[model samples]
Target: MEIDDLTPAETRVWRAFATGTPVDFRATDDEDPSDGGAWGAERTVRAHVLRALLLDGPRAEGEVPALNLAGVRVTGVLELQYATVDHPLRLRHCHFEDVPRLYGARLREVNLSESVLPGLISHAVRVEGVLRLTRARFAGMVRLGGAEVTGSLYLESTRIQAPDTEGPVLQLNQAVLGADLWAPGLVARGEVRLDGARVAGTVNLTDAVLDRPGGTALKAETLAAESDVLLRDAEVLGRLELRGARIPGRLDLSHARLANPGGTALRASSCVIGELWLRQGPMVEGVLNLRRTQVDVLFLEPEVVPAWVQLNDLTYTSLIPHEPAERRLPMLEKGDSYLPFVYEQLTASYRRIGDDDAARSVQLAKQRRYRRTLPWYGRLWGHLQDVTVGYGFRPLRAGGWLLSLLAVGSAAYGLHHPPPLKPAESPDFNPVFYTLDLLLPVISFGQENAFAPEGGYQTLAYVLIITGWILATTVIAGLTRTVSRQ
Candidate 1:
């Protein structure tokens, strides 16, 4: 690939690109056969012009001189399909007549910053260096599916407009990025697909705005990121899907606004993350679903409220600092059956750190929520047992009941002096033995039945018998529950 071998047109392109001299051609003069957009519109450079100037030799290694084609208006599908470039392509401030076709191409770097194009189809393209599309405007779909970039994929301030709501504006499934995938200030009309993508650094989408109202704005299932997935101050008009995604760092949703009324706004089910920070400035109109997500920490700040927060099967190791029980409890008040399990999860999280007091409070909170789910009569019964015996969780309270009843019966026998009808030579008022005989329903100590009651003692005897039966039933039920637990 020497300069002497170039054609007349190729030499002209090389003179402008290689020598840093400006070249202008009539874009409307020749109609390229490979036009991918704007039907019948004439283009500037032919498909082979820029390709001949930018293509690097197959064996070319290490860094070569960068091809600076800034502000150039290239024509029909700047097709560089499988050509390997050893140097970076700096096409900043350029206006493409159609989409660039870099599919399966190997490049050192590709920078199209501040450029205007119909679309970009570069799937399976391998870039050894960065790919910059900063502030670039796309009128159609931008497909970079399965592309592998050794460096970052910078799309900051980029605006993509795809009229089709069903299709994605940007597709990057399984695209591996060694550095950050910077899309801050990006505005996409269709879905932004990052499913199965792996980013070694952060997926920085901070302040990005995505608008796809009836459907998903972002689909990022099975995405694995080593650093944070920052959506700070960003806004999404539809659902943000992150199902089965793995982020070792925080998924910071601080100051983010999500709107998808009656449907799930943010679905992060089965995701494994370090922490999920829903700060006070965040707001979600629809459900914030975290079903089966395994997060080590959940840092929920005050004033962050979603229409519904579905935390079913969510497992977290701890609550972050300043996220007290009172503050976090209201977030679980979605008025659903999952409320009890959310409290249970909080209890388990606290117990994992040996915070039994916090665990107990969570248990009490769980019981309170459980009571809310019951019918009126069931609630009454639950409240009775909670005050007296803590719903069989407190077995020792049953002992308290027995002791109090025994003491009261004994005092009644000692003070009233109920006349005994036994022929034995015993004291007329044996309060201790008589009370024990009355309390133990299954075993008779020959003290209760051997004596006949007199005056109001008959009514007292009936009360003791009924109390004994009730206490026996409660003790048996508690023991059964404890044994079943084991």
Candidate 2:
């Protein structure tokens, strides 16, 4: 592995490293560059081995030019396990033509800036310091399972290609990230799985476009974080599942487009956050399932009125729901009761969009579904009373008395004139006499003879008159008592 005894290609690689010059390797037909004479075609192989060894050792104290490992495709695994370089290890403008394996490699402080890694497998890799990969592109699968990164993981302006079998483009299961996981302007053409990953800081995916038509764009479970999971302005072409993810701060999904047609579940079950907002978006398909998800402040912003169709047990300032527009208004009005406030703030929302009817229907359906929830007395007696009061049977009873009064008046008027007889042919032809003879008797006994003839009707007339008088007197007495109490 000495420099002088190395081949011409190896000498070239060694010269490049010594002079701090960029090493460029030409692409060959064979997958393994070592198999052909291509090994000597690029640079010193001994220098690469030396550089790898130095990276695994302690960092040099003085400032030096960043080690550029650009475009040197390794035939076998690029083993840089336990690397602790002080100077930023630059892999700028490099291309990994084949799948590169870097298992257990410790990148203390590295910058893979603007690199193209088509296929990469860095399982159990520990990044102690910052790992900046700004403007990098991944054409194939990238796995980083069980990785522990203390510093910020930057992936700005990166593009990850889709997998062949509708799998995730980037998988980071069981990884412990300390600083912010920033992926601004990053685009993923496949699913991005971070299941069981713990982020200490914010997991920002702002302005990122994720296209996963066959599956979910982001799937993270038990993702506990202090700061907000900011997905603001991020576009997901498929489902975004955050099942069992807990955030101490807000889960901001505002101004984001999430379109998943396969009935994909956007579950955030058992999650605890300050707020979970999906507002400010024009469209969001699939259910925004939040079963058992707890939020300190649930903001339904005014501009997001039509975004949500249904909600369940989402606690807010009030247990009642509010119209997005009216939520900002004062809760109390002049001389208004709390019931009206609750009704207006909560029930009015459903009533405005006709959802109240649907909610009532759902409640009724639930009553039928879980009949045992109610006691027998409540189900039978209380429910029947509710129906009766709702239909206003008391008002119908009042109308019955009015109908009877009108019937007695009409019958008595008919009996006095007999249709064929005229006023001029009447016996006395006097109005006062007619009034005393006809009107007084009719008023007194009209209830009995109102619908019958002379003899038998007279007997019935006395009974009906007495009964009618008694009913009228009782009604008047009840009204008096009610008025006195008031």
Candidate 3:
């Protein structure tokens, strides 16, 4: 298309545009010039007229006046497919009748801020400077697949509508971004994909809203970021998938709200990060799946603890739980009582930090939870043993019980002074030796069978024998439980 193919209004636009001057078409605060209303002296044009003028452009690089179509209503598709241009394009406050197609195009910089468009398709496109879509509105999908941006992608205050629910509103798969994805205040009606995207800087989605029930709102699989990924204060109505992603810096989701009832709210399996902070006022209404995710540090707040957390096989070096906040057990739908591995993961984590005491405490907590799931008879037996011996976990308690039995038996036998039960060269009433002979299994210290107890004293010896059996059984149980865990 040539400039000659343009209409009268378009002719005027071409004259000024081809001469490197801007053309404005906005009315004054009043009615018109007849009603003493003011206006700019620049010529007005329809979207098609300007469309032809843009296509027939200043034939080469460093073309006419930045294509500054500010405040103009474009009545057609701004198709710039497969074109290579070095000039800047600014479409601030413009209203497009259709989506702009920049497929396979190369541009220095482009700005479409404060505009309203159906959407934007720029597959395989490359831009040297920032593509500013701040405060813009997209009524359809914005596809930037395979695009390379030397600078940042600014989507701050932008609203994208994708009513299909399962479809993505923004597609940046495999895109290489040199700078940040600055998207604060973004309202995406569907998913925002970042699969295999390499972001050289932070992905700041602060205060962003993405709603797609039972589906992923953010699919950032294998995303490698040079800096942090912040979702602070954002609200996601579906899943936030970051499977296999690598973030050298922290992944902060502070104050974020996520909900995907009966499904995963966050799945970051195999993700590697410096730190993960899910603290502040964050609320997750579904499973928080972090299976096999490795992080240097993890920080969580009690207020943000979800009832259903899925941290199976998750590994972290240090944990910084906010005051009175413990790792909310893999609060599964049925609770984590049946899943001892969840507690074991936590125990192992504590052990990794050389905190054996904390590890033992976690193990005890696990036992207590499992104890509740047992049958009545099993529970009774478990309680009986736990109270006196910790169900084979508290060896010190067993030792104390054993010592009590020894002391009681020694004192009673000393007072009773039993006679010899069998033939012996020397029959002496040594309470210490007598108690040891009865307590130890299969050991003959000659004080037990050699001594004969009189009527009531025989009852005391039987009591001592039963106590020894109980103590020995408890000691073996404790040792077995401890060794089995290792």
- Best candidate (score: TM-score): 3
For every candidate in turn, the CA RMSD to the true structure comes to 6.5, 11.2, 4.9
Question: How high is each candidate's TM-score?
Answer: 0.77, 0.61, 0.82
Tens-place lDDT per residue, model 1, 48-110, is 566766664222234245556544556667888887877667776667877899999999878
Cα distance off (Å), candidate 1, residue 367:
6.1
Model 1 earns a TM-score of 0.77
Model 2 residue 144 lDDT? 80
Task: Flag clash pairs in model 1.
Answer: none
Candidate 1, superposed: residue stretches over 4 Å from native: 1-13, 19-48, 56-65, 301-312, 322-344, 364-384, 394-419, 422-457, 472-486
Q: Please give the lDDT score for candidate 2.
A: 0.58
- lDDT per residue for candidate 3 within 1-486, as digits (tens), equals 565666665665566665556655545322221211122223334555544555555543464455666565566567789877666777776667677889999887889887778889999899989989998888889999899999999999999996753568899999999999999999998989999999999999999998888889899999999999999899989999999999999899888898888888988899999999987775678877787888888886655657766666777777776221134433422344366776776676677767776677677667777888999997876776676678666768877876777787789888877776654565766987898777776676778877877787788778778777776776677678888998
Error of 2 at 19 (Å): 10
What C-alpha lDDT do the candidate models reach, one value each?
Answer: 0.78, 0.58, 0.77
Q: Which regions of candidate 2 deviate over 4 angstroms?
A: 5-66, 69-77, 81-87, 301-313, 317-486
Candidate 2 per-residue lDDT over residues 346-454, each given as its tens digit:
4434444565543333323333323335679756643432232211212234346535544564465445532214434434333223222332333532222222335
